[model samples]
Each structure stands twice: as C-alpha cells, then as structure tokens.
Target: MHSLPESKKNHLWRKLVWHTDTDLHPLGPFHLAEVYCCDESNGYAIWYVRRLAKDDARGVAGVENADYLLQYFSKNHRDAAIERAVMLANADPSADKVIAALDRLAGGAQKVSADR
Candidate 1:
C-alpha cells in the first residue's frame, strides 16, 4: 500500500486531493480502469472499479477521465482503500475480464469517433 515511491505517492495522493486540477493524473495498473486515493473536496474519498461497460464511461473525471464503480468518504482513512483497489484488481479475475471487454468497447468507440 505505502510501498510506492514518494514521487508516485505524491502524484497519486494529489490525484485524489486535487480533483479539478487537470495536471494531476490517475494511476492505472489495469487498462481503462484507475485508482484514486483521495481528494481535497471530499475527505479521503476512495473509489473501486468493479465491472465496466462501454457506456459506463459516463461521468468520467480525473486525468485518465475513466469510470469508477464505488466511491465513499473515509474520514482521513487512506492507503487502505488504495490497497484494496490494487488487491481487488489483482485478485478478481472476473473484474479483469470485464475491464478487458470494456477496453475493447472503448477502442471501438474511438474508431467510431474517428470515422465521424
């Protein structure tokens, strides 16, 4: 959880803290899905990615501007949620497959948009 380097840690933390800041980026270990630590607006709001669909891309925010499934306030509690997200992404084979399918759907969207 806390094993990330200071630089990456700072960036990850800020991605949650500074939500509106365009410069702050999301950390993506899995394709099309991302994990945000916390944000300044909401205290330690962590999100988890479950299964994603092509249209699940709605309400996208953050630097990656992707979708997330669960978001809750943690009242200064940190790292645990991020750790959970990482663990969930790694441990859940079904979620991984869903992400892959979503990725392909997203790719098709890009191609359609390009053709337009």
Candidate 2:
C-alpha cells in the first residue's frame, strides 16, 4: 500500500535475485523468498516451510505437505511480492515468530514493509 525508502528497500527487502542458470539455485527448498523473475513462466513466489533435502520436482503438491507452505502471485507489482509474503506469514499460527523475523528483516534492511 506504501513505498519503502531506498535504504530500507535495499536492506529490508528480502528479494529473490534473478539467475540465468539453475532456476532452483536461487530457490532451493529452504528459501523464504526468491527474486520474482520477470522473465520466468511461473509467476509466483515459492514459500518453503522446511528445508528441502533434495530438489523434489514433484513439489509440495498436497495440502498435507508440511514442507512446502504456499505458492502465490502478486499482481500489484514488485514490492507487492513481499507484501504477499507477509500476508502468508501473518496467517500462519506462528505469526508472532514469523512477524518478528520479517520485522528483523526490516531492521536489518533499515525499513519496514508498511504496517499492513
């Protein structure tokens, strides 16, 4: 809903950077967020709740999957990508802990991703 300051966007914004090689390199099974590739076919964020021991191509296909938490797309644009991430975190039962981590990202990033 709001824009983050340049400094904060650089530091707090946990983005998945683009890579030319392995699509999986930037996002293994453990990453919280990866760069939203503008060029990629799958326009969504991969949220992993657990560490992926191996690259399970089958993916977290079921609701019973405890490792793969969610996959989503944010049509609002760039910063919105992280926004969707926050929403997912907040929805989690461990919202307090997850929110704390996101808050820390803001601190380390020197900015918060709006109060929402």
Candidate 3:
C-alpha cells in the first residue's frame, strides 16, 4: 500500500493487512494476495493482476481524486465499509450479477443527487 498518496497509504495498507491476515491466510503460507495487498496501496493491485494474468488491458484502473474520495469515507465510515464490499464483490466472477445489482443502486443514488 505504499504507492497510494500519503493520506491513503496507511488506511489501505491496514485493510489489506487485516484482510490478508484475518481472512485469506488464517493458517497457511503467505499467499500472493497478502503480498499484493501489503504493498499495493499504489499500482500494486494492477501489478498483481498482471502477474496473475487477470489484467484486463481494456479496463481502467486507479482511483479518482484519491484524497477527496477518501475524505468522504473517513467522514462516513459505513460508506467506506460499503466501498470495500464493492471491491470484494467486484473481484468475484460469480458475483457479477450481484455487483450489477449494487451498481444499479449506486446509479440510482447518483441520479437522485444530480436531481437535487
């Protein structure tokens, strides 16, 4: 998580570390996920994707206005939790349908805000 801007670096790293240690590698060897999550607050997520041949060359990566976006999460912790859930869901191939449903909900929120 070193590559993210200074503000995001620590929090992302903590999440990655916590998720890796607590969820993925409860009792076994340190998996690639742990390694990637540990150092991937930056582009390391992309790096892992490439290494694992999961890189979608056509898809966009990276965060937008990282500081501003993270500030919103910091102020609303539950929103941050939702964001993480989206990330996890997006990672699962079987969950694409669920992810799409969540996206529709998110899109509706955008529409409501835009109408304000």
Candidate 4:
C-alpha cells in the first residue's frame, strides 16, 4: 500500500501518455488500462492504471489516484509478472478479477520464495 516516489510516478505517467487521435492508440477509453513496471528493492512492481476518460485531463496529477493498482512479484517472476500485466491490460476492466489474478500471482511468488 506504500506509494511510489514522485520521480517514479512521473516516469510512469509519461509511459501511460497516449493520444486518441493516433492510429496506434488502442480502443476504448475508460476501460483501457496502461501497465507500467519498475524494479524495486524487494521485487518488480507492476502498476495498472485504468483510464477514466478518453482525454484523461488529469494527467500526472492523477498518477497516485485510487484507481491505480500496484502489485509486486519476486525478481524470479519478472517475466510472468510482465506477461500477466499485458494480459490484464488487454482484457476487460474487472477490478475484482484483476485483484484476484494479481493475488494469485503474488501468492505463487511468495510460495516459491518460501520453498527456497
């Protein structure tokens, strides 16, 4: 539940920037999710941001909004974590499902570490 530093949040906001007018832009406005990952001391932190608007005028100011979901996984699970993030980002925006899936992944990571 700890928040990311302001510098890291700014970097993530930059990565999430997208223009609806661009052809490369993905479909859907509010349901669209942007995935960002950063290496942390304990593990890799994956952040999912579900856009609430097409324009998303809130910009960097909304980086720490409650709508953001942050999940951490051991470095050994980095690939899996990234894959899950991409899958969730492309899938429908179901908060419950996303949380459950992340919890499962985090559980697996913890179990692996415990086994070690």
Candidate 5:
C-alpha cells in the first residue's frame, strides 16, 4: 500500500543492525528481517501484504515465491518463526510496559533455544 516514511525505515534499520549480522544457524538473518518488516505494521497491514503477495503469484504454477510471508522468510527459519517474530515485536517501544515484557520473552526464548 503506502510506502513507509524514510525516517521510519531508518529507525527500523538501526534497530535491526545488531541482529542482521548474527550467524545463520537455524536460518539466515534476512528471514528475520522480513518477519520484522511484516510485524512493523498492524494486522491489517500483514493481511494486505499477504493478499498482494497472493495476487502477484497467481500466474506462477510451481515457483513458491507467491506468498509474501513465505518469500520473506525463505532465507531464514520457518518453524517457530512466528513465535520469534512475536517475541521480537514485543521489543518495540510502542508497546506499553514493553521493556519488562520483552525482557522476559527474549530471555525465555534465548534459554529455550540455547538448550536445543
């Protein structure tokens, strides 16, 4: 739909810089990037991306690049991706009481994943 403002994009870029360089063990960092981008907006925005992605791939038969989320996450992980995404999103400052909530979730996720 609408292009995000440069300022907003810049902010997101800065926030993501730390994560972009992480080693791709489970998956590459770009998938995480896509998930972060998709989560930046509300539910309606995610729906719009999905709808457009579907439309964009209507003509393609076998190539799996049609689904926006799938395409976005192709470079990284698929399983538990949404869960990780939700955890990352909670780190957004706009979420009230986000610091405590995000810390808990992030810490918990790290612990869980560490044992894997």
Candidate 6:
C-alpha cells in the first residue's frame, strides 16, 4: 500500500504535463511498482513486479517503457496510459495464469465481505 511522496508525485505530474500537454493525475499506488524517467528518451518507464494473481506468493519483475509525448498525446491518452501502466504492472512470466486470473475477475470472481 505504499504511495509516492507528495513532492515526487508533483514532480511526475509536472513532467507529464510538460511533455504530454495533458494535466492528468499521476500514477496511483501499486505496492511493487515504481515510475521514473527513461535514460534513453524524454519519457517515463515503469518498473514493476509482475504477479500472476492478486495474492501470488512470488513475482517476476521488469521494466516497461512508454513515451508520453509520442505514444500518449491524444485526448483519451490519460485513460489509455493508465490502462497500459496497469497491464504492465500486472505482467507476469506465466502468461496463462495471468490471463486466467484476469478472466475470472472479469467474469465476476467471488468478492470478500468488507467486514471479514
């Protein structure tokens, strides 16, 4: 449940606005993910630990690069970028397991009661 510090979030938001001309919220919390500037481009990359399931015991981590100025400049770019970031965050080596888990969740997996 870790979150970026306010200063860091502001920095990221500034960069996004400067590059994309879109004033959008910064990335939300993902316990095993981090966002940073890419050394090779004027863009940001996300490094994340990929898990096959929400409660998976182990994870495979890697970095995914996306160009904000180039790949995310459209009107709907914010939503698209967020979706891509989420997909990258959830990426796993066991693709089938990930797909199955996603399918189950999309098809209405059981929900836990908040009071539990």
The prediction achieving the highest lDDT against the true structure is: 4
Clashing pairs in 1: 16-38, 16-39, 17-39, 17-40
How many clashes does the backbone of model 1 have? 4
What is the TM-score (0 to 1) of candidate 6? 0.26
Model 5 local distance difference test score: 0.30
Off by over 4 Å in 1: 1-31, 48-66, 93-95, 98-116
Query: Which segments of model 6 are wrong by more than 4 Å?
Result: 1-4, 10-75, 93-116
lDDT of 6 by residue, 1-116 (tens): 99976545522222111121123525532222222222123334322222122443432222122111212323334444455545632555454444333333323323222111
For 79-112, candidate 5 gives per-residue lDDT tens digits of 3444445555455544323323333333323221
Worst 10 residues of 6 by lDDT: 12-21
lDDT string for model 4 (1-116, tens) is 99977757533222332224445545643333345666666676666544434344333322322334356779698776677566655454554454344444433332221111
**Candidate with maximal TM-score:** 4
TM-score of each: 0.35, 0.27, 0.25, 0.40, 0.21, 0.26
Q: Which residue runs does candidate 3 get wrong by more than 4 Å?
A: 10-95, 111-116
* Model 3: per-residue Cα lDDT over 1-116, one tens digit each: 44766744533322221122437557754321211222222322211111111231222232111111111233335444455534643554433343333333333232111111
Q: Model 2 residue 116 lDDT? A: 18
Candidate 4 ranges with C-alpha deviation above 4 Å: 1-33, 51-67, 92-116
Error of 6 at 11 (Å): 8.6
Q: What clash pairs does model 6 have?
A: none
- Each prediction's Cα lDDT score? 0.39, 0.36, 0.29, 0.47, 0.30, 0.32
Better lDDT candidate (5, 6):
6
Clashing residue pairs, backbone N/CA/C < 3 A, model 4: none
Among all windows of 10 consecutive residues in model 2, the one with the lowest summed lDDT is 56-65
Poorest lDDT segment (10 consecutive residues) of candidate 3: 63-72
Evaluation by TM-score, superior candidate among 1 and 5: 1
Q: Judged by lDDT against the true structure, how good is candidate 6?
A: 0.32
